[model samples]
Target: MSTQYTYTAFLYWLLLAGLIVFFLFLSWDLQLFQTIFVQDITRISSLIFILFIAVSVHCGYRSWFVASQSLMLLKIKKLSLDDLKLLSDDAFESRSVIKDFLSKVLNSHSEPDKTLATEVLAESLRGAHQVGWFMAGVVIKLGLLGTVVGFVLMLSSISAFEQLDISDIKELMQQMTLGMGVAMNTTMVGLIASMTLGIQLLLVDRCADRLLLETIDFSLSTVDLVVDNRGEGGAPLSAQK
Candidate 1:
């Protein structure tokens, strides 16, 4: 009956849903994928783009998992300082950033400890966002690379048209049309892939932001509870300074 177990199950279902959608698309028209890949001016780049998308999806899944875990922790109502301490210990043992952060704050009675914990938390947040953004940029750049390759193919056919006789005009036009098709097809595929992947990355970012805010709230609450507990024992928090 743990929320973490339920959340994990939900993520598994989401992954299943994605797989079903992919299979459905494949069944509807298998040739669409073939056309996109087979006819691409730079098939290698197209393959690389697909690889990047897979990587992005994986990164997004990881971000979602962390966000869900944090949200579950935050939903605990009427949590006491002891409960917070227990959660921190559990988190540290489980290798969770939020739990680790709480553990740090609980152990940190001095300014230096607090500063170090803050730095560690910031680094964790930065790393989560950095991979998503970096992959998004790489996907977009691959699309642009495909666009350039397409244009080059189209332009290269232009010289053949000039050397052809009048009777060969039809053949010349056909060649040029083929080149243009290659150019357009690759460009279209690249752009669409880039846009879709970028949107997914954006979603991951939004989830990360939510996770971060929740952690900040928890951290502040933990600090206040620790200070209050110390005060009740006739020791002011300032004494640590």
Candidate 2:
């Protein structure tokens, strides 16, 4: 399972890298970077937007990987206590919620203790989804920030036209137009980044939900197995025999 996760993560990153490179190539071919990044306003916003996109993509991949692992676990129709113990061992050797929960269960002697551990594990799983959501909000806020900055710059450019000289009007108008362009470019970049990241985050949220459900079900099964092994009087079956 650890190997599978590692392979999945590797493949996801590789695909992401390829897509980023392809996007860069396409932007270069379209001369978008040259035109949009010509000014400080657009350039800075674009850089921030790109950074957020990368973070969002990485977060999405992590969520997907975790969810995929949980889904795989759900496929097993039957899992005995020994099978679960082995799985728990593997999980402990790696970084996984299943391992943490299983470890807690193995150490816990009562149903209430196991239930508490399960709750803790669920919280841990939720942390990942929360991060994706927070980042998605940040991406949108950055875009809005760029929009405000662009408009401020555009308004400031109006000072150049105060003289109202006919001969200089053309140049002033050109400057004003440039400022508007900066404003629009930043706005566009921000919106595009926000929307793209929003979609990714949405998917992450869905996967997280499914993963949580499966984890809960698995924990319940583990609890039942432990209870059953203890026999009717809460004593080990082997002791009764």
Candidate 3:
């Protein structure tokens, strides 16, 4: 399939992914959702948007990062000039190289920057949020299109009879129904996905915050170990939990 078709297919798949995630949340426990509904609707919407951002970003980075780990992608932040040259060269041998390079670039951790956790979270989220933005725009345009078509149906119902025919009224109602369905489907799905995603994102964001805290602790106490090439001496991976 063409790249465009493939991407479009992924968007559809993302919706399915969102549905699955929702069901999984319910299976795990649905009480969390109840608390959210009690809050303001506007707040709820914002939360949903953020969820879309988080899920998309987390998922996008997870796919690539997990794959790179199998190749023993240690010291991603330490790639040298030679590695850069290898990456930039026309002679690069593998499709995986670009992905590796990206993994390294995104994984960078330098001095005086924000905590590694924050940077990592921000960098990883770009692609997913991009997808979310595109989907949101599509929803808006589709909504508008539905609005226009609804109007057309209303106008079409007013024939030269100058009096409303029962048949015309029935036909107009059907046309309006179809038009409204086409118009609102995207927006409704977008909003719902956005809301569900928002809730998921809050859980993730809080988790990330906690992880960042642990990472900071690791950085402070293990600065010597990390800088001395004793990365394994840092805190246990599960410390964040």
* lDDT on C-alpha atoms for all candidate structures: 0.60, 0.62, 0.43
Model with the higher TM-score, candidate 2 or 3: 2
What stretches of model 1 exceed 4 Å from their correct place?
1-30, 71-79, 83-93, 230-241
Please give, for residues 107-205, the per-residue lDDT of candidate 2 as tens digits. 678889888887877676666656766666776677677667777777777775667778887877777777777777777776776666665555555
Q: Evaluate residue 165 in candidate 3 and report its C-alpha lDDT on the 0 to 100 scale.
A: 65
Model 2 residue runs over 4 Å out of place are: 1-24, 40-42, 64-79, 83-95, 106-112, 229-241
Residue 232 of candidate 3: its Cα lDDT? 45
Error of 3 at 81 (Å): 27
Candidate 3 lDDT over 81-193, as tens digits, reads 22433443445544443233343433456553434444664444233444545554544444455445545554554553476667677766765555444334434435566
lDDT, candidate 2, at 90: 54
Q: Write the per-residue lDDT of candidate 1 for residues 13-83, one digit (tens) a residue.
A: 36644864685488448676666566665574466556555755665566566655565455432354445
RMSD to the true structure for each prediction, in A, is 5.9, 5.9, 13.1
**Sliding window of 10 residues with minimal summed lDDT for model 3:** 68-77
TM-score against truth, every candidate: 0.73, 0.73, 0.40
